[model samples]
Target: MSGFDPRPLLGKALDQMGELITTTDDSQRDLPTPCADYTVSQLIDHIQAVVRRIGAVLSGQPFWSVPQSIESTDWPADWAEGRAATDAVLADDAILTREVQVPWGQSDGAAAAASYIGELAVHAWDLAAATGRSERLDPELAAAALPAYRAKVPAEPRGGDIPFGPVVEIGDDAGPYEKVVAWTGRDPQFAA
Candidate 1:
């Protein structure tokens, strides 16, 4: 995890998103995704929304507390456009290291960078499943994200049982990228 660059992870996510969107056909537009209630389109839009909110935080502004309404029909183009905007925000050196507060938790610029990396990595898996793509994430970023994600795991034990399934096992011989995807609940065999 020492050589980790969060910015590049975000960039990779954006790239993966573009690839998914471009490769998707209308036949798969309405496919259900791994996200509990969201279709592929809805998931894409939500991912974009998160990215936009992160950009707002990076810019030292409050994000999504207002809960603006987004139409389901607007998902595709809007999501791509929003990601482009977020990419621009991340590209700015000032925001790269700037301190800001996010709704989830207070974090410095480095934290913000890491947060996006984790988010995009997870969401990329979701998109990959819905679109039938074999996608993997950066191992170092996933390792860095594990503690953070574990910390945020819900304390409210629903029905005295955690709302999760057994952990997916990656072979010692497996690549970090594969482990990252498996850890994030994505089947690496999904074909796009």
Candidate 2:
């Protein structure tokens, strides 16, 4: 499915996170994650920033002409609001396949959608782990995300300054959730 459109996956990722964030207890906000330096709050904020940018691009607005760092505040709520914004963008026909310049480079609607979906799935696992939640990416969503993630990584041979070891080797018997987490650089077995 090289020609796969990423909108459905993007929607699914948003739905998954929206459900979890709504239900997560406020007390679990301080847990750690496999995303190295990020705490639960920071991860949530990062997801929000990325989603917001995607929404802007999809709406034919400028993306980050003046990118400012955000302080971590009201993160869970930020995620919910950002998810709504991203959902709005995905539903907007004007931006989805329209040629737009992204922060990384120039891309069409399909590439942008795929990148956004793949990013959301990765961070959802980060949030799930930090919150001690059982949420997982849909199998089809995870499968759709792999190629996009791989494309984002540089092709330099392993053991460079990039810490990513390899294309995570997951078993055929592995569940979809595990595969997704592992592929995204999260240790599937991490516990808060």
Candidate 3:
């Protein structure tokens, strides 16, 4: 495929997540999500960390060099800042040609950005499910991310250190968001 510009899709996914975050109540922080190990709060924290790390990669910094942590309070504000920084970095076309270190190893910037786009989109759905908010994640963005996810993520076990579980089965007719989350091993029907 031609070079994929993930910035627009990333922006839409982040915006959808921002809407979902506002609907989250403090009472629901401990609620379970599709990711069996993570509570809603923990998942949100992870999303913020991923956003920051990806921003670092886009900025020509070593992605792992930045320490990742979630602020217990003011997480929404933290997410907004991270999103803005990531957006700014992605806006530069030069980033697409650069190489970045990601968890899977060194990859070109386009691949790295596409990976995060898939991650954020699926996690946004997880957060929405956990929080009992609307399940209407951006289908367009999900569809945009599906190819990269399918190409990179195998059907076999990804390993213990990998956060993703084995791919879950879903019907071929499933919607884009459902297909994306299922590819990440999340049951689309799961709720807190």
Query: Judged by TM-score, which candidate is best?
Result: 3
Put down candidate 1 lDDT per residue, 115-167, tens digits, no spaces.
77667666666777677674443456556556655565443342234433334
Q: Clash pairs of candidate 1?
A: 132-191, 132-192
Every model's TM-score? 0.71, 0.79, 0.89
- List residue ranges in candidate 3 displaced over 4 A: 1-3
Residue pairs with backbone overlap in model 2: none
Candidate 1 residues lying further than 4 Å off, grouped into runs, are: 1-5, 65-69, 72-76, 135-192
- Candidate 3 yields a Cα-based lDDT of 0.78
Model 1 poorest ten-residue lDDT run? 158-167
Per-residue lDDT of candidate 2, residues 157-191 (tens digit): 54455555454666888776677667655677888
Q: What is the lDDT of residue 20 in candidate 1?
A: 67
Sort by TM-score, top down from the best: 3, 2, 1
Highest lDDT scorer: 3
